[model samples]
Target: MSGRKYVTTVGVEVHVELATRTKMFCSCLNAPQGVAPNLATCPVCLGLPGSLPVINREAVRLGIVAALALNCAVNPRIWFERKNYVYPDLVKGYQISQIAMPLGERGWLAIIGDDGAEKKVAINRVHLEEDTARLAHSGDNSLIDVNRSGAPLMEIVTDAVLRSGREAEEYVRKLRAILVYNGVSRCRIQRGEMRVEANVSIAPEGAKELGVRSEIKNQAGFNHMRSAVEYEVRRQAGALDAGGTLRQETRGWDDVNQRTFVQRSKEDAHDYRYFPEPDLPPLNIDPAWVAAVEAALPTGYEDYVAGLLGQGLTAADVDALSRNDALGFLRLAASAMGDKTVLFAKRLIKDVFALANSTGVPLDESRLGPSAFRDAALLLENGKIAAEGFRTLLDVLYREGGEAERRAGENQLFVETDAGAVAEAISKVFAENPRLIEDFKNGKIAVRNALLGRTMKAVGKRADPRVVSGLLDQALQHQGRADHDRDTRLPRGKS
Candidate 1:
């Protein structure tokens, strides 16, 4: 096995459902879930005779935006083609897609490759089309839901550049992040808003030519995609090693068994019987319109992460904020807090996020708005609220949006900042623990922490720990000095 090495080559096709108000070729609602099946259908989407297809302008705009985000060049002339295929999901025996003139071409997305270096994955094309109805099977019977039919869908094809399953997963994750950041799609994989397919093949380590490839269809999640690609790589390698030939076919991933099973023979361009759509006119994208869309694009996810790191955020914190999909909220809170972005980011990642996770709520969906979050951070930074108080205030804000400072005050959660009060608390702790004080003077320095804990407990955790510790150390020092003076005088008298 060590001597027989293989190189895995992977390319991906991603399908994203656009967040549009209506379907691609009809004015029916584009809702896919929680609606009665076959209701969001029309003559245009149902293949009824004599109904013509119309293009959705908003979908086209979103396609162009997504293309630009991936660094693709928009084609000046965009046209739709008819792809003929027979499938239960595709009601129209033929699907309207693009082959010759797509919306954009030659785009690239950056991903951290398997070798721990930044690598760019070449995108062949990003095109717009209509989605098909969904098929649900149960007990040897199948149900069709046309609510998803005719919904605007964007298909992005990548060049065969990925080298491993990890690279493929990272590419998809980064792509999904970009899409969601730009408000292009919800990208809810569980709900089928986004789907991924991997085309994988393996060749000898130094082979100059490629090997036969298999298409893995509709991996619902990133983990599933990675697993399927890796399994196929091994399966193909084993077949080649056993003097068995490989075939071009489509396969489905059985997540339960963690393997890929054959679905059908793969089809090429000729099999689709491609031709231009007769109803819709070719789209002539204006240069100015393209410029406007490009200008409107938000900052890329990588750049945003870099900026946050530059602002003194730890890599772990950035990853947390990104994975939780709270970067948008972070940006808003940062803007509200001005130069204290790092402070806010830390609190959000540590405190606010902890609360959200423990309660099974997403941070972005919580009632903690930017203003309230900013105020809480400021309170913590200024020493007006102790750690416990800050956490309590966060809970209040998460449940009901209100002024942070006011809420803290209402709950008596403010830090005990009075020096006299802290001194009194320290004195009481020292008096109650005379043995501990004696132990401390005899060089049992660890007792200092115990004394400090007692002091905080006495103060109801309202006094800042740092302040309490300082006061305790000062009182202990004074006591030690007085004891030293008394010891010296007594020694002379006894002599």
Candidate 2:
């Protein structure tokens, strides 16, 4: 028989690669983009002898901005400590990090938990550090690219409050949004700009203390991180059920094999042998500048999401907008659209987003600005352009960066509003399809849709579908009455 059920506890650490022009402590270019190996290095980034480290003021400012965005309290005096670790990628024998006095602490953010309610996850600290070099391993060779070395990295650590894989995923998703919305970091998980580490443990049901956790290190994808957490939970529960003792250890996720494997024993704080940096002095944050940063913030992430939901956007749509960094664009379009907000949202999500995805271009990089989208959506809403015409206009505007109204006219995509032209198209379609006409008069009323399609095709797809349907219905009714009258005449005087 199995023992009592277990409960999961998770703590996540998110590493964000701060966006800046230079390295954290040096003037070397912070080029994560493809730069030749060793080209972006300097003495400070490389930790050469006789070199000194200087903090980047802009990096400090951005850190403060992020801290305020996360509702963390800024420390007046913060300093760096050398985290002593020996590895091939570490140019120096130690890393300059902050734990004794970090930039921010005691923050809390909300996420929608597994129970479909708002959950407040406590944040322990948000600190700034430098990234290590990238390691690429082949079958027989290992290489290090120092371009990522000494880049600015910010870490956010959460308390052990998450209960499930989904809660952990939600926490990361919401954190990403809050950071991106505040212009903190790009948080691109694909590019290694953002990374996640989860500490998962499971305890007996109604236990008073937490169980020993295995740290899952450097999960680059959100779903992979969730999977690692869930798998670790199950593994721990199985071991405990079989009367096996769990140990504290660090592990790596084998994404291909879908399991966690031991990497090393978990390190205690003493293992790093942290000591204060003797070269660089302590950091002092200005209250005035922090005030300005708080003042300059655009809007809170929670409020923005709430407003988007109030506009009837689904949660998935909001996620798409946030992930693509197009929330501001949608907001601008909605600001001017009034009651047509839904139409604008639909067009932005359905049409504009499709173009971006298909072409491998970002939505914000497109020439279809909010005003352009607004004009196009209005054309569709006001019956000036057919649905087919609107799509054509969108394709053109997205490709060539032209005004929607001008392009619609240039391409002759506007609906054929001329009564005579519509009637002629309808009459030609009726004359072309006698079999369909017979079907209509014989009570196969669904033939009206075919007539409508043929009419639009005759007009080069610029005819409004509503107008085509109305005219086709009237023509079919007239033909049906004529056929009825002839049938009632009793075969040439038999009546």
TM-score of each: 0.75, 0.75
lDDT at residue 492 of model 1 (Cα atoms): 18
Query: Model 2 — which ten-residue stretch has the worst lDDT?
Result: 486-495
Give the C-alpha lDDT of model 1. 0.87
lDDT of 2: 0.85
What is the per-residue lDDT of model 2 for residues 1-495, given as tens digits with 9 covering 90 to 100? 385699999999999988889989999888646779988998898889999999988788889988988889999899999999989889888888997999999898988888888889999999999999988999999999998889999999999999998899989988887877666787778778889999999999889999999999989688999999989998999899889999999999999999999999999999999999887899888788889888977667788778778878899988777778777666667764355766677778888888998988777556787788888888998999998899889888887887879999999988887768888988898888989987776667676777888888898768888887787777777786787687752212212
* C-alpha local distance difference test of each model: 0.87, 0.85
lDDT of 1 by residue, 1-495 (tens): 345889899999999999899999989989745668898788998989999988988999999899999999999998999999999999999888898999999999988788888899999999998999999999989999878888999999999999988899999999998887776787888878899999999999899988899999999899999999999998998888888999999999999999999999999999999998998889999999999998876567677788888878889988898787777677777763246878888888888889888888777567888889988888888888888788989999898778998889898888887889989888899889999988777777778889988888988757787788888889888877788887842111211
lDDT of 1 at 302: 78
Q: Candidate 2 deviates by what RMSD?
A: 5.6
Clashing pairs in 1: none
